[model samples]
Target: MNDFGSLLSQPVAQLGASIFTLGHVLAVTLIGLALVIAIPVMAMRRAARAQAQIAEEAASRARLAEERMAEIMRAQAEMQGRIGTIAEVFGSRQAELTKALSERLDGMTSRLGHSITEQTKSTHENLAKLQERLAVIDTAQNNIQSLAGQVVQLQHILSNKQTRGAFGQSRMEAIVADGLPHGAYEFQATLSNGNRPDCLVRMPNGAPDLVIDAKFPLESFNAIRAAAEEGGPEAQKIAAQAFRRDIEVHIKAIADKYLITGETQETAFMFVPSESIFAEIHENFEALVQRAHRARIVIVSPSLLMLSIQVIQAVLKDARMREQAHLIQGEVSRLMEDVGRLDERVRKLQGHFLQANRDIDLILTSSEKVTRRGAKIEALELGEPAPTAPESRATATDTAAHGRLRLHVVEDGE
Candidate 1:
């Protein structure tokens, strides 16, 4: 029995030791669980504080945003009111600008219409003027055609020698007739040598007549011109020589026929109808001109001949004036004598007028005396006393004196 009781005691001690170790394990586990719970609670409390701080900060930021939005809204309202006022002002200004532009456009439209009307009128006037000018141009063209025909006829005439001579003669005659009076010049007049010159201008005071010959050497001159234009130099030289010979021959013939010692002027004119031919001769043929001058043959162009005729006309007029000088002087003397006689007659008439004036004054005085006497006779009444003898005698004496004065005035008037 003792052994068994010892074994139970050993097991019971072992069980107690195991229970103690279990208690320590339990205590350590409780501490660990408390610590874990406390740590979680603390973490939860800190998260709550952080959430409240975040909420407060969010509310402050939202208030600030609200304040900014309110300010923005007020500014927007004010801007809208300003925009409305600006729109009203812009509308009024736009209306004024539109009205001004309309008035300006109307004025411009009226001006444009008036300008167009003026331009149309001016265009019509210009067209009329242009038409008139065109008509004038047509008339001028017709005239030019007629002149061309006349020029052709003249060329034909100049081609023939006889017709050319006649043309020159007619031209010379026309110049002479136009410059000198009728009866002063004679055409185809016969000289003392029985040769009929083209013209003879009569000189005053029995002077010798002046002679003019109109025939020219035109054929050779024309040949020279043609050869110069169309032929070689040799032909031109030959033509010039022939022309010179022809001119010399014509000059000699004219000088022989027209120059007479006592019948014609000492110098006779050989008229060249063409001034160009005269100028050519003078410019190129100095020797020929000298020879003609020595022969007393004056080569003259149409203008020179006209000038000579005018000089002759002046000389004739001067001679006529000289011839009438004595008659004019005699008439002047007679006029002076008539003037003297008229002056003497006027003096005698003045004397007669003065005598008549004196006689009229005496007549007026006698009339006045007679008028006073009649007044006195009328004033006497039928019942009045008669005049005294002395008054009657004085009145009769006054009447007799008045009658004597009246007779004296009448005799003086006669």
Candidate 2:
């Protein structure tokens, strides 16, 4: 230990006396080489690590991209399936809408055709009715023209006194014939006093027959009217006086001739064929009318005389009904007795029908029992208990009867 310490302190090595060995030199050289190699190796190793890291990162990114692509492909498949379903739905809907539209259009077209046909028919019917109405109106117009010509001819006939009297008599006869039955009235029949009346209505109940005279004082009334229209009071007054005198004389003549106490009615009718003349006499010569009434003469227009004839007919009808009252009552009583006999016979027949129905019910019950016994016997021969027989059905009957006779048939089933 002393020697080693003296050698390190000897400074064999004082300044310029430093000692060098092979081992020391080699040691220093190895150290330097080691430093140089280690530095480069370390740097290469760092670069390799960095490159490995980059490669790892790239691999991760590729995996993520593949995953995203798989996801996108799956989504595309799903979207395609959804789109196909939507298209199918839309197609079916479109077809349905088209068919519905077509059907609706057809129905509307049919309806339009029917409406047009009906409208055309209605229009034709209306046209036909209008034509018929026009024809009717034309016929009415022709009738009016014919009536005017007849009125002119009537005026010519009425210009003569004899023709006017005949016209009045004809009018009165027509009225009497239209209103009364045959033989109830007589035309131009001479009375016991030798006065021939225009018409005589025979009253019932032994009453005197009514007399109707046709002659009237129309000439004097026509003169008065003409004079008045000529515009002079004196002419009108003179004409009116003459008309009064003529009517009074005619009334007296009719009363004397026609009024037979036992043969004619108490009051006699003076028939005036013209209602206009009747109205004029009443309006302008009321005093003459009163005088005629006092003389048992009733002045009548055609319409008034027709009404009187109708009254006479009604009276005759009432008298005939009165005369037949007892016969009608006897017929009614006989009819009632016959109805009573029919009712008694109907009741007796109904009783017979009830007894027959009861007897039929008994016979049907006996037949059903017999059929059941036969079924039992058949089962006994077969050596087995009889199966239950089917239930009997209700009977049906059709019957027709008149008075005491009847026809009927009954049917039954199981």
Candidate 3:
């Protein structure tokens, strides 16, 4: 049991001890609890003051951000307005340039078409006029060719040599007929002297007269034209030369026939129609001309023949003057013969007048005797006077004596 009681007191002791310890422990614990609570209140008050400063700074930053966003929106609106104004101005300028180009192109096309139409019309008019002129030129050319052919035919007929010589002779005769009387010319005359010549000129006095002949040579003169006809063969050429020699023989024959002696012994003539032919004969055959002249043959051209005819006319005129002088001489001889016959008759008349005077004296003597006888007888017979016998007889005797003529010398008139 003690043990039990000790245990209980001990327990009390232990409990008291425990209670005191507990009280001590409780006081210490309370003091530690007050220190913990006061430290928590001081730390909590410092944390609330820091939280108030952080909230005021956050509100100031939000106000600054809102002002910056408003500035950006205003800038975007100004840029959009400028872009719309530039687009409207560019559209108006493009429409004006396109309308000006279209008007200029239309006007140029109409001008080009008008110029081409006018040029085509002018070219057609020029072509029609040229064709008309060509037709007129062709007609004129054909007429000219026909005229040329007719002229050539006329020239061929005129060149025949024999016909040409006859033409010249006829022309010469026609000209000479105008200047003189027809009786003065003798064409193809035959003279009284038994010579035939081309012409025989008569002088005033009746006598044999001058002679003239026409000489015409053909072949020698024809040879001068050999170039006109080509003599093809040698034999033909030789025959032409022989023909020339025959012409020379005919010239010599004409010279012999015309030249002969006449009353005056004058030269004879040979007449050639051309002067050019005369010149050719003289130049080529000088010896033949000299021989002919010595034979009293005179070669004469047309000009020289005319001069010779004038000289013959002058000689005929002088012959007529001499014939008039001979007639006057015969009349003077007859007048001298009549004067010789008148002188012989005057001497015979003087002898007859003397014989008549003697007869009258004898008659008077017989009458005286008769008176004596009568007186003797009258003694026987008475005598008386007769009255009428004495007065009447005296008147008759005076009238007979007055009728007689007297002459001394005969003058030219008697």
Candidate 4:
């Protein structure tokens, strides 16, 4: 404290180190003047530029912020809408579930009657409806059982030889089930010569197709069946060889009937539905198939028929793919034409935008000219309006519309 007082008592210590000598003081004063005037002048200009940049950045950020806020509000609104929608769905589901219990569901559906009878209350009010539903269930159960019995009866009928022929007809359906859509395949088709082949396999070439005829020689088969019904082995050996002879004769009969000129191909097909019959022929009488082959008659099994169907399917697919390839080439050409038209439209649109910008610039220049005139008027006194004329003004709203419709009036000089 004593040292501070001594230091404080001196004028040079209190103020600074001393103004010192006159030349030293003058040099320090000059440096201070340079810092105060020149440095501040340069800094002030830089600060003004920085302030302007800050204002522009603030304006840009404000615009971006507004856009983000708008997007957020829209998202919030959409979310609220979705929440309302979900609430409605849940309310409806709850209402339905509640009604499912409270509502007396009576005879709404005959199909649902059984479930209702089992689940409903046993009260007197529900008893009549329940009894009605029970009656319906009884009737339906009986009908179903009867229908099942009928189905069994039908199956037994099909086990007979006459009904077995009908089985082969629906087996034709298995061939139709091949991917060869209905257009390519024909069934029970008649030949050109008044002969109806059982089924015809149309060739890839639309001419001279092969014919397949189903000939179930069931008479001999019936004889065999009868022999089995009676007992077995007693009579079939003599009649079995006779049955095999009948099969060979049937093959020859088909060749004789259908192998006419312009009617059937020399090499024709005889369709056999049962593989057991096929196996029996080849196992016992191996020469029969070979003899049929010698007659230019092929005995085709169901497996062979399905294979034929697949071959037709391949043909149909090939035809379709080839057609699609041609169509793709046509579509490519049409797409290129569309692209060219789109480019032309884009060029025209650019020209229109450029002309519109020029028109806007004309309006801006007219505005600047009016501002200059306004500034000139502000410098003059209000009493000096008598010496000066009013400044010219033009605005888009004030422009006179010159558009007029032309009408030609024909006058007759009578």
Q: Estimate each model's TM-score.
A: 0.44, 0.42, 0.33, 0.38
* Per-residue accuracy of model 3 over 247-294 as CA lDDT, tens digit each: 456556755565555632357666667767678668865765776676
Ranking by lDDT: 1, 2, 4, 3
Candidate 2 structure lDDT? 0.67
lDDT of 4: 0.58
Worst 10 residues of 2 by lDDT: 391-400
Candidate 1: where are CA atoms >4 Å away?
1-167, 321-330, 351-414
Candidate 1 per-residue C-alpha lDDT over 1-414 given as tens digits, one digit per residue, 9 for 90 to 100? 876555434422235446334445556789999999899999999988977776666556556555655664565566557655765675676567557656765765666566556555655655565565456556555644544454454344334444333347788887777666677889998777799999999999999999888888788889989998999999999998998998899889888888887888899899888878899999998988999999989999876776687678668756655554444555445545545554555555555456555655665565466456445645644332245645345445555655665565455445
Candidate scoring better on TM-score of 3 and 4: 4
Colliding residue pairs in candidate 2? none
Arrange candidates, best TM-score first: 1, 2, 4, 3
TM-score of 3: 0.33
lDDT, each prediction? 0.70, 0.67, 0.48, 0.58
Error of 3 at 87 (Å): 99
RMSD (Å) per prediction = 52.9, 33.9, 80.4, 34.1
Winning model by lDDT: 1
Candidate 4 segments exceeding 4 Å error: 1-166, 177-180, 205-207, 225-234, 259-266, 332-414
- TM-score: which candidate is best? 1
